[model samples]
Target: MMPLEPVVLSFGAVLLLGLGFGSGPCNIACLPYLGPVFVATGSGPRNAWRILLPFTAGRLTGYTLLGTGAGLLGLIVQEWIAAPWVRWLLGAATVVVALSLLWRRRHRGGGCVTDPASATPTRVAPPEIRMTNGVATGASPGATSGQAQALLPGGLFLMGAGMALNPCAPLTTVILAAATSGSASAGLLLGFGFGSGAVLVPTLVFALGVAHFGQQLTQHMNRWGSALEHASVGLLLLMGMGTALGWIAP
Candidate 1:
């Protein structure tokens, strides 16, 4: 049995870690994917929150599920991680990802440019029509509802959930290790805390982006995106090097 106080404390610590992970360019992993979907929906600013709410909800749900899984499989995961070679392999994989990101940045010019034409949504103002007894007197054919479903709660939720499900070795190890230290309940709580922390920065950022769709948001995404991406990747690379050197157990 896990000690209650220590488990709770560990959970709290992991939660802070989650927040740090989610707070930076890693948040891009969560935001960029969902942002384009919302833009494609053509719902415009009016439905911004409608889109954001579900995505956040889905992300949180995904985190909870990940935690539960980790806790339940704690022993197995720990055992697998016990092998020295596995740790080395993970360290190598981390380095590979960091190198890949760096290469991509160098070759592709850092995917930070938001096309001006694309920034302005193609959604036209809804046509004004007089209605009487459920009859439209001046219905215009300008409105397109083809992408309406994509703007729905379900679509947004799926987008957010998918992002949460994006593979992350560090997060997985964190979850599994924390789970191994305590009961499944503790693991779940730890993951939950981590997820909550992770969502904070991205949530605020995407929320602002959605609420105010214009040049400012686009500029920030394009200009600062590369810097943030590099910073995040650099941190990961350092961690990988540290792990490879056996400076840390993980």
Candidate 2:
């Protein structure tokens, strides 16, 4: 049995490591993957969590799984992640995400608009709104329309998971510590702490900031929404291609 003190210290260290890196390096690393998706989704501050929660959960799951593997298989887990096939799979997945986004943008017509002549801004009511008993009511966008609503959370989850799988220095450090810990439970604990620390701050602050800013930007620049949307799609395509072709490091 390992000494409890060492394990506790190790866990704390790994968590602190995550916290230390999360504000700067983690944000930088994660933004490339998350920023475009968040912006293009056009979610407001009120609903941003709809996308963030699942994505954060996916990352936590990925970290836990990686840590467990490290503890169970020692260093062998590292080799598996480093394998070319893994990169290829992630790359393919990225390409698919890009394509899906492209399709959604094309199909989602009648975006927010404003009239220069009118005192009050008027735009197309979201498809999610309905008239019930002659009373205007809003419904869950995904309640009846299944796939479209599910796509954001589901894709974001995959993106989060894929991002976690990419070996960041903080994650690598945690994995190594967990591997040396020699207990799956210990690894899981360390992984959870680290994952929680890494995401708790940035996920809330950075994502919410982006969501708020993005919504404002979209509302103000409604006329250019389509162009911005196209640009986002283009960015996704480039990221997908780069990931697949090894132009971007995994």
Candidate 3:
């Protein structure tokens, strides 16, 4: 019988990584752009089902592709590097990243770039704002809001793809390694299971009350969005530290 340890470990790693990163500060930073898609669908049972199906489908595709790619890479790494050393190196790097985040949080206010225009005391026009065609007028071109909604199925697909492209979770890396260490096919299948387990609940929830949740979050917590961002960062740092210290292990 095949030893189940590798597959089980990969599953746990992927699940933790997904949950940690998905709910962390980085996600909050991206929320302003992502929130509208959820909220635009309106919190109806039917609409919820509709939105979730496509989103999950997109996410599943993304995770599968990522796993495939990672599995291939893992095979290369296994040939080139010793496994224990690789794990330690990754563990160390993860800790360093976490430390950097904490350091930035601590010393964030030191560097300040003041506008020269402010010193010159020029009169500034009140920022003109308007609404037209059910969209905010005078909105900056770079602004993203409900923009994802505009793209609908395509946009959601891209979002899922992007999420997998550069997953920040340490566990994700570990899972990819574990999966690839064995059969690439096994790794890919495990990746699918991990992504499925992690994403299922949130996608379902978002589908159910996307619109209501969007409105409530935007209207009430917009100002506090930064707070959410910081909280997420803290969570990621904590998770990274826990893993590094072996308080939590794959």
Candidate 4:
């Protein structure tokens, strides 16, 4: 068993690292993916927690797994993350998610058009409306079905976990320390502690700040709602490809 004191110090160091990075670099890293969802969904303060909480949990899960692997496999975990195939796999997953969202939107006939009279965004489709030229025949433009709604939480969770898998400078340093520690328990402790600190800033910013801003933007810019949604989807697609092709640095 390794000395407890070293593990304690390492844990503290990693926790501080997460806190330091969480506000800036870490937040930036998460924004590319999360931003689209926040803005596209028009997540407000009331529902932001619903999205952010699961994501935070997912990130913690990924970090814990990485730390445990680091302890168990020493430097092998680092090698695995750095592998080219891993990058391709992560990128592919992102691309798939983007496609899935697009498909759901089109298939569900959920277009988000503004009611010019009320300046309000509605997701409900009229019964009198029918399919035309392969357009959405069911839900209003941009609205998802109950099935899609059910999967949203899970998707958000996976998104958080996936983001955490992209190792950053601080996280990599912590992984190195954990790998050398030779104690799985110590590594897990450090990973979880670091994750705890890492999520703080994102929670405040994404769940509260971004959410409020996104809702306001959606409301004020109701006329451009469809364009915004389309743009977000396109952004996700580009990012997914960039990540997969090594054009984007994690």
Worst 10 residues of 2 by lDDT: 127-136
Q: What does candidate 2's lDDT look like per residue over 155-174, in tens digits? A: 66776777677777778778
Better of 1 and 4 by TM-score: 4
Model 2 TM-score is: 0.81
Clashing pairs in 2: none
Better of 1 and 2 by TM-score: 2
How far in Å is the alpha carbon of 118 misplaced in model 3? 46
Model 4 ranges with Cα > 4 A deviation: 1-10, 107-144
Instruction: For model 3, state the Cα shift of residue 169 in Å.
Output: 2.1
> Using Cα atoms with residue i matched to residue i, what is each candidate's TM-score against the true structure?
0.52, 0.81, 0.45, 0.80
Q: List the residue pairs that clash in candidate 4.
A: 109-136, 110-140, 110-141, 110-142, 110-143, 111-140, 111-141, 111-142
Kindly indicate the candidate among 1 and 2 with the higher lDDT. 2
Give one digit per residue, the lDDT tens place, for model 3 in 83-171. 34333433343344334333432332211112222332221110100111222343332224324224344534444443443344443
Candidate 3: list runs displaced more than 4 Å. Answer: 1-13, 16-30, 40-45, 75-151, 179-182, 214-250
What's the lDDT for residue 218 in model 3?
A: 30
Q: On TM-score, who's better, 2 or 3?
A: 2
Q: Which regions of candidate 1 fall more than 4 Å away from where they truly are?
A: 1-9, 42-46, 75-151, 214-250
